[model samples]
Target chain A: MNEPTRPLPRANELDTQEFWAATKNKELRYQQCDGCNTVVFYPRRHCTGCTSGNLTWKLSKGFGTVYTFSVVRQSYHPFFRGKVPYAVAWIELEEGPRILSNVIDVDDPLVDVQISMKVELVWEEHEEINIPLFKPVD
Target chain B: MKQRDAAIVGIHEYQSRDVEGKVSALQIKAESAARALEDAGLSWSDVDAIYDAGDGGGMNGLTIAEYFGLKPTVIDTTNVGGSSYEFHAAHAKRDIASGKANAALLTYGSTAHSNARAIGVGGAGGAGRHPADNMDVFSGMTLVANYAMVAHRHMHDYGTTSEQLAEISIATRCHAMRNPDAVRAMEDLEFLDIRETTIDDVTNSRMIADPLHLLECCMISDGGGAVVIASPEVAKNCRKTPVWVLGSGEATKYPQAGGDITASAGAYSGAQAFGEAGITPAEIDIAMIYDSFSITVMVLLEDLGFCKKGEGGAWVEGGRLRFDRPSDGPALNTDGGGLSSNHPGMRGIFLLIEAARQLRGESCSQVPDAKLAVAHGNGGMLGSRHAAGTIIMGRD
Candidate 1:
């Protein structure tokens, strides 16, 4: 089947290229500082914890808990014009570093959802990138 | 070095309007400066420094200086979001104390109304493929969504109800009812209407983001504000009574960079301000805390030590913020704040103006015998990359 079309993130940047590339294989990768053992997200070259440049990528267990969330009832983006009332949340990964993603498979996710609810990483194939998403574990 | 006293000797604001044939942003700045200088009984030559708190993206100080035909030795252009002017005021106080500048003029103006730019929300433009657009692209992040996330987290962690947040909007609307200069009364500005609002009204309002209703958001306005800060000697010679800058503090942190959404840098900045002022939170007579949204005030109250963390929702209940419950706290947002009054993008300067007026006994809803006032503003986002500028003002 053809990949569903959506706004795709660019993977040409020096810092975030690897993270985007990893998403193509359904992997959630974050950088681990060699000196401080700190995990960083949004693909950083240096450790935010210790400012160390010696960093390495590691695959996440892909499971996390909902830190906080909001149901985007209104959107200015033309892509989301008809897709109102979507739930978006910040997931606190088990390995550390929180990432923002949409929570699917739940009705009225904003009201029915609870903090610390278990969720796992998922992916949506778009024209240009494999977008990382999350869903509450059934 | 001993800290020399500095004070705000004059203040003025161009009414927020949206008339046809609106003048340039620089003209608004010039008019505000001229009026503020007149209010302070000073001429252009008296302004030894100029601080541009302009939100427009450019070299604000140079632009304003050239437009106003001033050649000050010092030109400060510090941009920290909505609270940039509070930071400017803090810096100006220090500059005057250190003899770097004798008279510093701080000015701000925005054409959000004239340009018809949606002041809040996500602003104009849609998400496009950018090599650097990060995770926000997929999530479809907007300003309302960001604050709603905080409200949701605050509710989950502390059991703070939506009703609690709504109370802030109600009280601010009540305050706005008393301010003739508020955006609500602006002619031809029908959307800026100020009317009686309740918890039910807030809860029933159209949801911009889950948990944040239309009532909870701040009113966008096009306004200009100016304040002249001077050394104690110059303040003594001014036309109006000088409102003393007792203390000021500023802090900046970014989200996705370890900033806590529920907690802001106001905790640190407020502590620094209160410590410098040698006063306690209870001693404050009035507070002009920024209210970009209802949750903004709730989080700030907790962070600024008005109440313990997680107690802000409870503290504001039962007409506490309206100064109705004598046992609760000081008068909050007496000038209606951004929620009901005017939010011209960045609202930091308005906070200073309101606080100065309260201390000067010039506010319409004047706190009885108001001696000390606190003005705090948060800029940026709920968690991601924010600035908090807190100022403590007093009448000595």
Candidate 2:
């Protein structure tokens, strides 16, 4: 009965706390502008669109579209070597923020990622944290 | 704009293929600064300003200033990319424009390819703090991958082939065949010279990073080059002919700004540079755009106004860069560029060097009667953070 592994968010302090806290109830959250009702990812204190500092944390539907991706076959760091050849993409969330994410649940050759493919979130647990990756919505 | 007088009167460089020391990279930069001042027929007494024309964030300016034992009127350690040197060239113009300072000297050095086991910068782009007591900064993306992705896009969108890229590399090498200043400077290769190789041949060429072959990227070295700029009045008094800075422009596009540079803001920068020079990109004779990657040269051809965007692949494929053709337009990166020239970290000065030399007819492989030459340097890769500087020189 090994404890299920959870993933970490961005390799930074601010985002890591956000990711782990959301999984306290197994939910995915993004920063939403309290004033303009705009949503942003990798939660920040202000709205990039309107320069509003009033932002609130809210759960997201976990949907996005693949804008571009790279199949990284070479690993520059030990932390990423285990996931050699993983699909890393810059996804444009449906709610309007962009994030660097991993595309999961696809078992094709390296060249299958087409631009603007609909994707949904898929969480994978690594040790103490759950990381949210994306999968084709289809 | 009312222009204050500025000119470059002195020039010096440390031409060591390999020079290593115990102190480290910063120390090398300081030492090179000292050497350049001495060779320029000037001492620390002549410099009124100094700055790192690099992408920034490292201790490059502090290092050079401290080493030379002079407090500059203007201090900057800036980095735009390979365009940094050209930026320096144009920076001299703006500095003169604002009456910021009297004379400025730009210097650069890198031991990335030094034989004495010197290390590269913490990384390429300006990001992440260095480890405790380390002078290097970390770069998130490598310049090669940046260029390759752009090259791939250029190919995907405009039918640019690896073979066409191969041709640019081959032709650049052809130019280097006669240059005495380059390591690969004297290779006798033709467009078809390297076309017969397999993917393995391209793959094994030398993976400086990834997605780019060895031949497709610039060389690294532990060397430094310097240029001196002053008011045109002062320049007329220098020992050598002062290469006038007719016009220049610098621009930056945030990495995440747009999907493609076609509709984005790069053209404004080029137009700005051309405007400052009071000439269009069409009037230029020869161009020396930064050449960290072959794709960059291709992109600059379009961006700098040589041709339209997406047409770089075909423009380069033709005999435009060929030497045998009439030297009418676009024999870009004439000194083999970073692809074939000596790319000592800050290779921008080398572009200035080649441009000045061409204007003086002092280049080893001189462009015949090349008077009004244009040399451009991009400060960062694909302009994620781009700094473009254009130098238009005349013999008269």
Candidate 3:
């Protein structure tokens, strides 16, 4: 089969590259406010919680629980057609952040993916970006 | 609250993929506008004001207005990301408050599926020009990447897992199964069947920029939806029972959603709406929220005070969104949210229409005895860098 096409990596500012780099390792990391010690999700120069310019990057333990999700049985885009029955979810990280990701592993009958199933990291290599995925931990 | 005569006497929506048929954005928008007007039993000449709520894509509203052959003496093009309809309500309120407009019409449409770079006027009355900054979403974390980071942060902090998120998707799909317009809804589908789906499967799923898995983002639909807002008198004169906009509020946070989502968030948006409505969050009977992304809904869980700020992950653990439970808990998006509902170009209008229908007890699939309802919107992401509005609605 021919190589399926992919969307090129969209942005490349100096600050965002590191976060993307971490995704390739299947290890999640975020910038934290050095002042309030609040961990930030999208890497940025300042903390949104405490207005602190002091921020630091920390590696995540790569664990979380599903918060909310949906299974897309209809693909609105050619990019997602074959994956119609795929899962889309918002996993709350152990570090107090909520992000969107894919859920893998296990059998999904009505996908009782549940509201809080434990999950860990998995990675998918795209043409330009390595995407992070999660699977239910046994 | 200021007593006004405006009511949504009409409602309609298109599918999430009509843009695939190669229809121009304006054509789709005009079709929706006409459909809504016809549903309301009105014509274009009755509209004294017009508001165009479009994501920074095509400048189709004015073009459509011209094509429709109506002269709107009072007009605004508040092209906020997704909250355009609600924002249009705000604009109408301001116009009415200032005694500028009598009857206003709000319309939204997009073709994110066809064009990557949306084009519009460089100045006023132009489309694609949002009053808020778009650099972060279009360029920074983009859509998927930024939310991915937030999902990662959420996982690390609350110990939320991907399986939990997957469960949300699964449950929503079940809800979608009942909605005919839902782009994707499957009762028999499971997460594992899709676990192996590659990034390519998601990437091509309709790449609206990057890092956002095809599934992580909202549909880049080529359809349009519309609503007409008139003073209370005109509304009462119309055919349908008016679902009064009792109270409403709009809020903004940081300029960029590419960082921590905690500060300056949805709570502010929810607070304003509840405050304006003079009702506690506990009093809300039903909700039709904007679910542009899964994270948007999760954050609203905390923002609306349904759960503690970070406890949203645990709130839906038991499939509580199902209609089986008839408790004080708010019945939400009973027909399927943006996730399962029709996520055409202008999604907020769908929420507004559904909220009105629920209040009118006219929904095709009604939430039993739904009297008071909330229609919330997140124009962008968690931070509200763009614009987020909440409308507290009640049956008259």
Best by lDDT: 1
Q: Candidate 1, residues B96-209: lDDT per residue as tens digits?
A: 888899999999887677677754555224344432355566677678888888998899889999899999998888787788886443343565344758899898889998
- Give the residue spans of candidate 1 off by over 4 A: A1-6, B1-4, B123-133, B183-187, B256-259, B323-327
lDDT value, candidate 1, whole model: 0.80
lDDT of 2 by residue, B184-224 (tens): 22232112232223334544574443345667776665566
lDDT of 3 by residue, B1-396 (tens): 344435667666755454554776667667877777777777787888888853434665556568767888776777656776877776676675566766677777666545643111001111122212211221122344345445545655677654444434444445555566653321111222322232234334543322234454554445567777667767767767777676667777653323445433557777877777777767677767776665566667667877786777777666565544447367666666655555654578778887887777876556777777878877655532557778777766
Q: Which TM-score does chain B of candidate 2 obtain?
A: 0.80
Q: Candidate 3: TM-score?
A: 0.64
> What 10-residue stretch in candidate 1 chain B is worst by lDDT?
B123-132
Best-to-worst order by DockQ is: 1, 2, 3
**Model 2 score (lDDT):** 0.60
Better of 2 and 3 by TM-score: 2
In angstroms, give how far residue A7 of model 1 lies from its true place.
4.0
**TM-score of every candidate's chain A:** 0.88, 0.76, 0.85
